[model samples]
Target: MSQSQLVELDEAAVLGHAGQALAHVYFPTDCLISLLTHRVQPRSFEVGQLGYEGMLGAAAALGVSASAFDAVVTGAGRAWQIELPHLRALTRASRSLTLLMTRFLYFELSQMGALAACAHFHTLEQRLARFLLMSVDRLRVADLKITHEALSLILGVRRASVTLAAGAFQEQGWIQYSRGHMLVLSRAGLLQVVCACYRQDLSTYDQVMLGSTAAQ
Candidate 1:
């Protein structure tokens, strides 16, 4: 704890790339980190995300230094950071911390699987709803400072698609958007729009990580 430091992350800050060696791990306090795929040119998509509930660079605890995806700060805020070597040493010295990391890894895998299915089976509207709700949950803010262009890249869709869906959401009184800012008007309305994957992912996290902690 003494070795860790708090740092502010700027929006769209690239932390690490796929196959790159990680220098530090970050536990977000009020930020969102996205793990994106490596595609040709400017084409890439978010596979998973981390916020106050999770940490970046979990692979370090498993004796892995290379990153599996490109990590970027999508939401700007503060985070507690620890260098990779210090993290490795701490995990070696702490059995409980190691156990926790293993559990978190499991939860991440479960989320990735759920996301894959959700992408294939769910409609764009449902996916957008889930994304917005998840962001609200992580940032703990209803007013999101994001734009349709960014959403297109993150959700791997066309900007027009995001605009259409966002417009519909606005018309339904679930949210309000203008000039890149989106204010969630009714979470209950979004809850009705989102797919089952949203709740399933949360349930997996509670069972795999939170439930384990309670048991101990």
Candidate 2:
């Protein structure tokens, strides 16, 4: 159960269900997963995201028996899996692991704060820009092989809206979309188009995870 291997999951694959105790943690190498809160009305919104920079089961480390959100694989990539017992033992034995987990927790909190603010104040275009930049940064790739439908799920927007926004981004030469894949043409340009929430989240991650590491 403590194998150090990478695995890929398809879209909508349940990493874990809501209210279910986590048995294993996932460390994404290039994959991205969304933490969503599902309501009785079937409305779900992304509360958090995981990528190569972080792990998925930090809640179990904090002694939480069940998660409030549903963890779903949004993109296909490699992820390292570790059983909960192994994870806890490793965390206790390694100060570096403890620090990494602590920093990631702080980053997640900051992301939640940013999401709240963005939902209330930022326009759709600005929010979309921030979302794209974040996805690109996490994947560490210029091209994102995701459809507007998947993006709508991640962004908690209507499919039509995502399509329109993507069209606008393409027309501005900020991004190029072909067959469910989006290519960032100009990172700087996209940053300019995004709101302050993106930078705020990045700063939090840099301060906590990277420590003295320079922010880029």
Give the winner by TM-score.
1
lDDT tens string, model 1, 1-216? 888999999988889989889889999999999887774576677778788999998877568868888888888899999988988899999999899999998888788778877878899999999989998999999888888888887788889999999999999999999987899999999999899988997899899998989998
**Cα lDDT, model 2, residue 151:** 80
**Candidate 2 per-residue C-alpha lDDT over 1-216 given as tens digits, one digit per residue, 9 for 90 to 100:** 345566776766888888888888899998888887763354566778888888888867656778767898877788898888778887788877776677787788778778867867888788889878888889899888888888887777788998999999999999999998999999888888899988888888878778733442
- Model 2 CA lDDT for position 109: 75
TM-score of model 1 (CA atoms): 0.96
Clashing pairs in 1: none
Please list the Cα RMSD from the true structure of every candidate, rounded to 1 decimal place. 1.2, 2.8
Hey, what RMSD does candidate 2 come out at?
A: 2.8
lDDT of 1 at 88: 89
TM-scores for every candidate against the unseen true structure: 0.96, 0.90
Instruction: Report every candidate's CA lDDT.
Output: 0.88, 0.81
> What are the per-model numbers of colliding residue pairs?
0, 0
